[model samples]
Target: PDFSHRLAEYAAALSTRLVDLRRTLAEQRPDTYLPDLATSLNNQSVRLAALGQTEQALQAITEAVDLYRTLAEQRPDTYLPDLATSLNNQ
Candidate 1:
């Protein structure tokens, strides 16, 4: 249980960092790292869910799915798989 709790905490912290990085990259690079941010968030969500942080995990995955949806709209071949994966997680 302690290990699970620690893992959840770490996942939450990493999610926060990913959000900050996404915002910074968006401002500095403008459309260059959005996919990376989305992927990181998706992975973080899985980690969060594994440790029972359902609400936070859901929020993270939802954001990832939204990002993937937008990206897929522009290039389905590249981002549709991500969208599908996030949707499955949701």
Candidate 2:
């Protein structure tokens, strides 16, 4: 129980950070490092789900999958694997 609680807290914190990073990037240079951030968010979602934060995990991964899909469309060779992983996770 304690471990799961800690994991949920960590996932929430990480999700908040990712949101901040995305907002900052959008305000400063909208096209920069989005794919990388999305990948991080996807990984965080996986952690959240493992911790049993189902709704939050689904929301996070949904956003990540959308971003990955867009990235994969632009650069299939580079982002297809990431997109595939995110899809499988979802």
lDDT comparing candidate 1 with the true structure: 0.85
**What would the per-residue lDDT of candidate 2 be over residues 16-48, giving only the tens digit for each residue?**
687768757755764777876787678778777
List RMSD in Å for every model shown: 1.9, 2.2
Query: Local distance difference test, per candidate?
Result: 0.85, 0.81
Worst 10 residues of 2 by lDDT: 22-31
Q: Cα lDDT of model 2 overall?
A: 0.81
**Which candidate tops TM-score?**
1
Encode model 1's per-residue lDDT on 9-38: one tens digit a residue. 886787778777886886687589889888
Error of 1 at 32 (Å): 0.5
